[model samples]
Target chain A: MCAQKRAKSDVGEGSPARADLDRTRAVLEGPEIGRALTRIAHEVLERTKGGEGVTLLGIPTRGVPLARRLAERIERVEDRSVPWGSLDITMYRDDLRLAPARALGRTDIPAEGIDDRVVVLVDDVLFSGRTVRAALDALNDLGRPRAVQLATLVDRGHRQLPIRADYVGKNLPTSLRESVTVLLDEFDSRDAVLVGPAKARPAPEEEH
Target chain B: MRHLLSAGDLSRDEAILVLDTAKELAQVSGRSVKKYPTLRGRTVVNLFYEDSTRTRTSFELAAKRLSADVINFSAKGSSVSKGESLKDTALTLQAMGADGVVIRHSASGAAHRLAGWVDGAVLNAGDGTHEHPTQALLDVFTMRERLGHLEGLRVAIVGDILHSRVARSNVLLLHTLGAEVTLVAPPTLLPVSVHTWPCAVSYELDEVLPKSDVVMMLRVQAERMKDAFFPTAREYSRRYGLDRERFARMQRDAIVMHPGPMVRGMEISAEVADSPRSTVTEQVTNGLSVRMAVLYLLLGGSESGIGNQEGQA
Candidate 1:
């Protein structure tokens, strides 16, 4: 979904037209997404022993708001605020040279820092797992965490790297030609997971 | 975006994009690991035909921070001293598979000429009296950092306008960024074509200081002057120099800037240069960020994908 927007701009005026929205189907609605995130927040608490020494770092674009939402849920349940920030992985991507230079996103590490703390990386969708790979490289530069775990709202399985998410909201089996898009109310008008025909050429390596 | 040959090459949006990119790249420097793997395998050659301390080091450091393999080539000790032509030197760098070439030459438009010879991106460090785009970029970055925005900010560039590449680049870039620029210099030091530029001209520094938000003092290039552009040093200092008395005439929040290697008593007073209003030191640090943005914007992408992707929101 994100790749199409970039591909459209890359090709400029002569680019292939956008995929038909009417042909797409919503896999997860707003309520379903909320419930999944609530469950993931509880699972994070369970795994980290009531969320002690844990920091949530979101990958940019869609991942940021998802991390904030998870932090809010964790705060409501535990009656305490959780440290959360956005981590941009544009500088660490392997395919940077394949495409044009990307505009850098914000990387706001919490005041407490991530050193010796359990870092949970949250993203909207996990596909080829390359974005996670890039995020891990970006995390190494910031500070040494005690351990790093991956969490995503949706896991549309097409793993390129030997990576697996620790906390997944939905386990979706998708074809290579299909595009999985996770839209939130923060960025887009609606909050739903849509499945549609691949727009532009399929950038299988793009995991966002 | 392929090569930053001149500040004039940048439009309003393009200039803003570079500044914005520099703002994000600035955060990387504060990290424990002050490097990015973006240009891991790329090669950047720092080809210097002229002598420099800040600009050469700044470009080298910026390339290194991005993890690009850097090759520093200075003309003093190199084959250029043995009568090797610029084309021959460029061909050698081309053979080395350079992805980017940062050039500082004594000849004006040297970077533009090098761009024609090499397949890699050519960055103008400073041409003879043409332009120092990166210096202007860092200056603008420093202004935006301190003043919050560039739009409608009053900038007064004072000193040797005829010989200063910094002045030319700053005038072009600051104007593009929507700042109101006024060049303050003596009649002899002012360029003949200064009236044609997109800026106001002022003869008295004292008259412009009170209305200025940024007072950029250019170094009086004594080496470049064959004849007398001004009278004695003391006489020029009394008239055009930015002393403590002249500095006092500036607005309360106004800043005094000098692109480095500043002549202490000639152009800017020592007290004002060391004062809180001075951004001399900050300009050096900001130079690294601005150069990184230029390098990343030039070499971070494919050759064909240059202009299409930089304006991303």
Candidate 2:
């Protein structure tokens, strides 16, 4: 998502005011995000038949907290905790040589592991689908899962791979020139989804 | 960042970055499939002109764990034994499109010379008595893991300081990381330029033991010593060796470290080397992680790709 990229760029520069933020529109706010996650939690339980043998694996940066939130929501309803952990896909990326080497993120597997379990790969945004592809490759090295499903807070159109999210918080359609930013209180001090003109040049393929 | 030639080459931030990156890469070794696809299709050539078991194998395993195709080219039975020039051998590797070259040579500055002749990144495994940056890195990694930090930590490096590339590199790196280093050795074994280094020198190991947070014992290179540097090996062990008496003088939480192939009885006691405080084996495991970090940083970037693009322009 653009939020992850934005946070990375903000490291060198003290949070500069971008002109694009002025033209952006907020598609989802804090309360809306909470409700959407709750609905997704219920949907996951229904699909997996009471969420048995389920493990939530969040892709790093923003996806980790998203996965934790989903697990908590599931615990509230089912009176049982679902195993959750973070899976960093930086090593499995196809576009590694395209840019400078990235600092690796943490990958923590729960004690139960992912073997023979349904792994729900969670992320903030569904864009070019390359990150999901990398996640799938990374998961292969971790353990064998019975089935792997995709979950995202926002499912923007124009997926480059033949992948779709099984559980999507919002279906927001936009042009390729627009950037979708997901801000979570766990990272950015607020919860909001914004659609705006590309911050830099128009990114043909938005990196997740 | 391009080549790991010396410990002094890394800034404080750059050094910390490498250590942090190694911390993440260390997790891969514990996974069910202990290989990452980060360096797939890339070739890392281990060109060793010196005989080594631990360092050469560590570099090879590190490269393989990153999924890089590795070619081990030791001097034994290789073209180098037939009098092939270093330049010519480097050129051959360059022509073969090596993405990275890990070199351990008998002559100092061999890795630097190879860097000038090759397009690939050059990693100095151990270049004569010059510097072994990765070994120093693994030492710091092990220390940081045990001590939780390097800032303001007191480290006393004991034994042979003159012929040790590990001692040279560790002094430079530990100083850069804000650790106070004290070199404890006989005046004959200490280098003439010891004062120029950013560390204090001590002749009595016993006096420095209690104040130190880490005591690193350097191997007395018996093979490299042509003349007698000391009265006798037994005399050196009695005066400077980390025996039980000196070990008890150290802080309760102080760690004992030796970059391997140790002259156990001469430099460190057998009991101390096997003690819970000894990080010798942990250093070997950390070496693999540190080398992986170096290779990933040097090859994972788009610098090589950009160089090719510039050539076209």
Tens digit of per-residue lDDT, candidate 1, span B1-313: 3778899888777787788889989997789999998888899999999999999999999999999999999999999999999999999998989988899998998988888888788888999999999999999999999999999999999999999999999999999989999999999999899999999999988889899999999889988889988779999999999998888888999999999899999998899999998999999999999999889988887652222222122
**Local accuracy by lDDT, each model:** 0.87, 0.86
Query: Which residue segments of model 2 deviate by more than 4 Å?
Result: A1-18, A201-203, B304-313
lDDT digits (tens) for residues B1-313 of candidate 2: 2677888888887788789889989998778899998999999999999899999999999999999999999999999999999999999999999988999998989987887888778888999988999999999999999999999999999988999999999999999999999999999999899899999999998899999999999989888888889998899999999999889888999999999888778889899999999999999999999988889988986752111111111
Model 1 alpha-carbon miss at residue B80, Å: 1.0
Judged by DockQ cut-offs, is candidate 1 incorrect, acceptable, medium or high? medium
Model 1 stretches astray by more than 4 angstroms: A1-19, B304-313
Residue B177 lDDT, candidate 1, scale 0-100: 87
Model 2, C-alpha of B307: deviation from truth (Å): 16
